[model samples]
Target chain A: MRFDLEIKCKKIVGGRTKGKLLLSKKPINFLGMVNTQSGEITNTSNGFERQNLKGKILVFPNSIGSSVGAYTIYSLKSNNVAPNGIICTNNVDITTASGCAISNIPLAFIDNQRYNDLVNCIKILGKNKEIEITLDTEEGKIIID
Target chain B: MHLTRDEEKGLSGEYGEATSAAYRILVAIGEATDAEKLVPIKWAHVSGVNYNTIGDSGLEFLREISKDGKVRVNTSLNPMGFDRENLPELSPEFIEKQFEIARAYEKIGVIPTFSCIPYEILPIPQEGTQVSFAESSAAVLANSHLNIITNKESALSALASALTGKSPYSDLRIDENRSPMVEIVNETDLENELDYGLLGYFTGKTIQKSCTGICNISENTDMWSLKSLAAGIGTSGSCGMFQPKKPSKFIEKVNYGKREMNETRDELNTSEDGQLITFGSPQLGIEEISKIQTLMDGKKFTKPCKIFCPKSVFCKAKQYGIIDSLQKSGVDFISDACTCLTPLINKKNYDSIITNSVKASYYMKTSNKVSVALKSLKSIIKGYTV
Candidate 1:
């Protein structure tokens, strides 16, 4: 059987979203930190340079950049490389929160323990090893594999 | 949340697609922030003009929104990526797209004031009035100095506010919510602009995410010092607002000794071998420009220097013949845009840049293709003059 685990998280943005998880331990400043076209993390502090954020549930601690970060998130959406969903470990700021809302991206907030456990789930990047995330706002569920 | 009939209709698309979109964002953010209702605003200042920063995706959104949206209140735009007077040498990748972004904003009824220091160009609203402002330095000034209510609006939120002339009534708007959570004591000698700017950095760092009460400020604190100080705080930290302890209505005192201030300054101070000297990160006002003019009265810069400001302030400053002498001294005056945001300055030309603005120092390293060294205005002048 496929590994199925349910994680309790606060649903910030509404709508059902499902994808593989792309996690960042550091908070991102969407403005200069992400390449909207390629969806790669540009901020060095993020520790995952050149990694794409598209088609994944981006997990970060929170936002810590310019106010235009919201627009950067929307740029991803229009460019067709937008993240399926976002999960913040601690809290979401006005910038990211507005970005997720504008682009209709699904966002959820998980506690520190569950976020760490989720991060550990995909620690070793190997072939056929990915943490699949399914977020349903209506049912208020975050099922992970 | 309570919504008036007009607001409900607008949210339901009574006004148009743009207004509907704007209202939806307002309501969503308002609900999320626990704001009770929407409040009308007297002015709105918007950011996100640089094409290099926002990309093609931003232009598309602006084009569509500007075509369909109508701004109900007086709005001022922030600096663009290119100088509007005459296009400076820029990379081919961004030459065309930069002006296109400005066109989109212009189409949407935004006045092409093209400035970050809108508080200088326009009349300051009476105390306790509400406004929706985006630029961090300007928003802090509105809250702390102007006594107006705003919570540092996001680009999208500020645009939405511009479309509808209303913002979510929360944070600084509520008189009760204005209580200071922390106090910052200025025990260090804040002699000049850089010292005050670094003091702001210390204050913001010491009390992250809290309304601040600044203590021991010199009685003769001028607008320029406040501008630099606020710019530093807004650049490094995400503080809501800061006020003098004596003037603040409520806040508990927190000691900010010289040791702590020095430590923070030491951390921010970096030595980088560079050439370009820049001023007007937040777009200097008349006072700061005049000060620079007087300082550089009989001086010439051996190295290349630049000043970024808007047309309004530049014209007002030029009337006194200060800009002419500075230009004669090899200072290039760039108007209607900021240099560090776009391809305005070719990174290959300069090794690094020295600036009095903490905000410019941060962006020069982060977005611009150059290193930054922070220096005081006095030192910068002294180096060039004597």
Candidate 2:
């Protein structure tokens, strides 16, 4: 099923475009060991075991756990392991928003009525190096490159 | 943005290298919140601790900034995950680095409290009180639980705030931001302090993005239980800030149990007859120490136990003749920052631990796997095992 989804997020800092896309299917926990620089879930539970997102667009449902989660994102950006962009199914969690704002990681929120279906459709999109994320909000539509 | 003359001078790089860094940090934070001007602050808590656990560069940076001893400011410090004095088994180089970092902070007037729960040692600000705090958990707790006004100031901003006694008026300093957006209703009757932790988890899961205040806490709520709940909520959500209903006598009893459970979790054992007792995991206040002394005046300890308290408190107890009385009862009073953080426990050491604080219990679980039975100080002094 093909459908269009759009969202709006406060632009954090932008990063250099790398050639790989590491996407996360499940929601990410801010407290768990996610190597911010490597974009890899280094020491996490079984759910996030072996997940690495270096140079990929991070697609998750939301951020879970800890106010420091926001700072950790910035830490990852500083270390250069941060994702090129982020696309969330819903409104970005506060920590994620703060991190994105602080790190200048491009963010887009997609409003798909059936988010699960859209996630499945976009599953292949995360494997690519360069892809545009169209963010639609009342303010305007911003095409993040 | 309107800045005081000093702030303007600092921003203009008139105050040398370190002050310039502080000024830039404050300006960035102000810009983020769109704050028009910076306000004067009285005290500040600084972060960026360099120890075995932190980055070497961060530690070096802190050392450089703190070397001058010219920074005469009232400042609190964040916790360093690694403690060289406490953990002697670690690497020698790591320990040396930690001592160097500690010395730097001490030179800069940052008391080596090194506790995340600074409110336990530092005084809570009154209503309309403005201070610069960097630790997020403490900031949320102080603002939401204690009704104080503080921003989650950056590490550099906290230093600047301490130097100038002012911060940008934003976020937590504002009144409207402190109000609870979400109200949590306790569906079940919470009996033990652990139940409070579970409830906090539940609230964080249910409330999503909104700030919450938990209502309908049972009359038997204590500091340990509240601290446990707060920590759990903090782990579960971005921040944990809740105001609980005032606790009753029963709640105080539960609080003591939480503390004992925390202290005895790893160091001692509790049989059906033996109760592992703990003191000063939360670093007992003077009032609590006095009360404990009064209760132990003529009591005898039938079981081997440990009393975890601060060096300052232990000295005070020694000065007041309370330490003599405690020693007579076979209770070993140990001066340590955090007993729960200690890795000196064996499986056969104790069957159970009795504690009054919830933070002790929660953190102890990381190293020791034992049953923790929590009770009140009154019960412990009465020679009752919980």
Residues B263-367 of candidate 2: C-alpha lDDT, one tens digit per residue: 333322233333466654444544566666677776677666576655555677788888887687777765534445343332456556666544444434323
- Shift of residue A124 alpha carbon in model 1, Å: 14
Q: Top model by DockQ, which number? A: 1
Supply candidate 1's per-residue lDDT for A93.
60
Superposed model 1: Cα runs more than 4 Å off: A1-10, A22-26, A46-51, A109-130, B91-95, B246-270
Per-prediction DockQ scores?
Answer: 0.47, 0.20
RMSD of each: 3.3, 7.8
lDDT of 1 by residue, B1-386 (tens): 58899999998988888899898778757755668998899898988888877888888888788768988898889888767767766766577787888888877788888888898899988988889888877887788877888876778888899999998887777887676777776777788888878777666555655367788887578988888788777666557688776634465556667787667656555545357788887888888878887887768887788888889888987898878888888888888876546466546776577777767766666666566777888888877554
Residue A138 lDDT in candidate 2: 26
Candidate 1 lDDT score at position B333: 87
What are the per-model numbers of colliding residue pairs?
0, 37
lDDT of 2 by residue, A27-129 (tens): 5654345654456776443265576765666767666543345555656766777766666654454456545644566655555554554444456555343
Task: List candidate 2 segments past 4 Å from native.
Answer: A1-9, A12-47, A53-145, B1-14, B27-37, B47-52, B67-73, B79-87, B152-168, B218-222, B245-309, B320-336, B339-386
